[model samples]
Target chain A: MTGVTARRRGRPPRAESGDTRDRILTAAREEFSERGYEKTSVRGIAKAAGVDSALVHHYFGTKEQVFEAAVEVAFAPALDAPDAVADGPLDEVGERLARFVLGVWENPTTRKPLLAIVRSAVNNETAAAVFRGLVVSQLLRRVAARLDLPDAELRVELAAAQLVGCAMLRYVIRVEPLASADLEAIIARVAPVVQGHLTGP
Target chain B: MTGVTARRRGRPPRAESGDTRDRILTAAREEFSERGYEKTSVRGIAKAAGVDSALVHHYFGTKEQVFEAAVEVAFAPALDAPDAVADGPLDEVGERLARFVLGVWENPTTRKPLLAIVRSAVNNETAAAVFRGLVVSQLLRRVAARLDLPDAELRVELAAAQLVGCAMLRYVIRVEPLASADLEAIIARVAPVVQGHLTGP
Candidate 1:
């Protein structure tokens, strides 16, 4: 009902602002990517978005908040992927988790946000905190809840170590062979390893 | 060996400069750690070392060369571990590799340079490239040579991904449980995963 009513309005106020907010965030992502966390600023992001400086602050509050919001938007889709991954067969959870996460890296859209996080997170404490919280509390916790094991969190983290490391080399560091290897080949070789971390003896 | 003559020198010109070079490199590593790659400058590094900028340039040509030299020294001890690691029992290679690599991170001395690289590599292309060269060409290649498999190089990288990721989480990001878990506990849980990546079908 809310959706229908909102759609019916001529130049809906909320939707219009929502569009503005999205525009600012998109600009913020680009700014951070090009200049990094420390060098990027609200005024610059606002200028890039073609919005008033006050309005940028009004929408995002602060630069840190802007970073938080931008990553949240970028990571939104990937966060939902593992939301459903837990209900499947226990035996194949590793492949499912590995593929889904790596699949996010494989896809350009999801890859950009994660790449931003991975890129910025290394140099800045704020970025690293945000990345850790998102991967652990939001992403891994959802997966861990399904395992119903005592050491599920540790297991999940170790599994994450493997996946994150591979992605770092292949995508971030852009190392040879693995960086260019077929996605399926990596999935085949890496899936079982991820599985071992998730459910090994 | 030449070691005796070097030790016997009364202010040997070579050893005196070697000490100075070590001091400058130490200052450079500290600067990189604190300010990151982009914000760091050769002038600032020289200032920290209490040396003339000309001497800094004399010893290490540019900022990039300084970074390469700093990480090379920081990683010097670690670079040697895998050199001998390849000669060990193949089946136990995973445990030995994991223990040694993670051990490097575990030791405060070796960990500092690695921490600098991991922290800086995310945002800087040069740092990432240098780290990739060191870890791949210098470190993983040695271990891969011993595997004698067509896919050995890829396999070794995968194993590195796992260890590197775990170290990132544990040491850099400082994620809980895994970060604070007893070192032995991490090795016990993570070694098999590394083994799987190394030799699994």
Candidate 2:
């Protein structure tokens, strides 16, 4: 404890490593948002963060790693999706998912980075690959595992496709009616479809 | 009939405007695919077509118009979607839509330009707006109108979201399981959810 307080102000202590990591992630998110995956470089992100490129390599080893970290942060809320299935009644899991996924897009803070990830994933093969890995392995598969039903994985993916498509149109593409429609009304219509995927015969 | 016989092959008749238009659209799709919307210029497209830029201007007034024309060509198959709703039994409309939308992505000839449009729409705001307009006005709204039900538009949009989301994952993002799954299996799994959206109580 004494060593923590005794450190000099000029140099950042090891404890500040978390802050440095976060600053780098913020800068990376901004760069990826502006230029996308192919055009963004580690040096560029480091320069934006006022850090050495080597330091960036030290924390996040590669551009893919950096992008993955950025995605994790962007999708932090969505990572909680499995809990929606875990916590709710099986029949209502679809409604919980529709509400939770849409809620992420409706919130402005999450939407910015999400738009970047969605845009980058659409345009770049590598970004899409990484995005797919996270969505399938980390998010959707975990949700599917809870269903204990035949074709459970397919059902979850279909549900995911539905939710992802809705987000693409309503938030990123800004398709009207759906884009400006009431949130609950959308949930009311979409939840049953999702529920059918989760529990239907 | 005399006018049809009067046309000669040299320099393409003035009546051959349709062929010239198709060539320009093909070139535009290629350029937009390679460089995306912002970086793609009329001169670039015209050069690719082995024609003068003025000819491109004569055919399509602006870059936006050229892009719109390109979208129309790419979405030609989907333009028939209204008929899918119209020709099918009301109960089977969902299966018809799921099969038709997925079939567009499955066909190599159509997928190339559709991929370009999806990639462009995701990355560029102007492109997304144009894409949203065409999808909502030309495709989804027309399909929605045929349903004799309250909130038909919203129901159709919800179904579109699900199907579009599936295509985004399967073709655009190339997410697995969904991407590689058998076509009939997917149709079987997805149609019910779509049917529910269209005919749910």
Candidate 3:
């Protein structure tokens, strides 16, 4: 007879084992979101995850790593953005980029982690460094490479500033009608401005 | 000696007192610019001014107050931007706005306090709140009022995003060649884009 699967296997089953890592990341995200970088501790993430603090240390090594894991999980969707914008026609590039960015921000799944990261950067040195690294390496560098223009890097940087600043006002600061306007309307009005920065005379 | 000499008394004394207030504000601006909000303390401002800490506090009740004083000093020039842009023909509006903004950031006297406030906002909730309040109340709201568009507020916000984002990348992040380029060239390229967001098709 097939023996009952051992409740405590030598190691946790692979499928279920991955769940622990995910849970820890989720808990860390929540803690960081609510408390910010300086206030968030590894022990707090463990408590929230309902795991031993040592288990958290065992898996992530440090609070910064835990934070990094949370950021990676949150920003995972954005990694595809370059491909999405790059695949589109040259003229429609701005609209496509704007839509992809707005789409990421509009989704609750992504917005929470983004808000957390932005808030932390505004209030912590460590978090700001991480944010700068992610934006520079992951997002801006790709866009800069794609643009063929004088001061292409500056154009990309300007595009990023415009995008991020708009998001900050709309979502983080909740400044007026911007926070309440339809996403498509925003795209139509602002995308070309960004496009102009990227490709205009 | 008899009765006090008129030259040394009354109005001149008041003028000297005004000079002290100006001196304190100037010193605070330098301190905040060089050291940022968190690093620059009350004592530091006082020491820089060669005055007592209590006098610094006496003139400005708190560090936040000192920051406010410094911002008022730095932003007085920028406050005129709306009027300058508004007075011009709509076609030239973008160029004018861009020039004014770039001029402010490029000026060492202004850039310091502005940078301090921005850097502080990234790491201090109080600072961020103050910044949000200033931007929303002073800048965005004014721009929104001037625009005759459907979503005027959103447009203003988008315009602001473009402006502030460029500043972040060029000045704060100092992203390469853009940071080192000729001011007029940068302005010519970016202003039209910003203008489009403010008053575009």
- For each candidate in the order shown, give its overall lDDT on alpha carbons: 0.86, 0.83, 0.76
Instruction: For residue B164, give model 2's deviation from the true position in Å.
Output: 0.4
Clashes of each: 0, 0, 5
lDDT of 1 at B81: 83
Candidate 1 chain A minimal-lDDT segment of 10 residues: A78-87
**At residue A1, what lDDT does model 3 achieve?**
22
Model 2 error, position B1 (Å): 18
Ranking of predictions according to DockQ: 2, 1, 3
Candidates' interface RMSDs, in order?
Answer: 1.4, 1.1, 2.8
Write out fnat for all predictions, comma-separated.
0.71, 0.92, 0.57
- After TM-score superposition, the amount by which residue A101's alpha carbon in candidate 1 deviates from its true location, in angstroms, is 0.9
Best by lDDT: 1
Better of 2 and 3 by lDDT: 2
Write model 3 residue lDDT over B1-201, tens digit each, in one string: 645676456566779878888888888888776656767798988888888999989888999988887787778878777677656677776677677767788898778778777766655567777787776677666666677677776766777777777786677755556567777877777777777777876
In candidate 2, which residue ranges exceed 4 Å CA deviation? A1-12, A77-81, B1-12, B15-18, B77-81
DockQ each candidate and list the results: 0.65, 0.79, 0.41
Answer with 1 or 3, whichever has the higher TM-score. 1
In model 3, pairs of residues that clash are A122-B122, A122-B123, A123-B122, A123-B123, A161-B165
Candidate 2 CAPRI grade:
medium
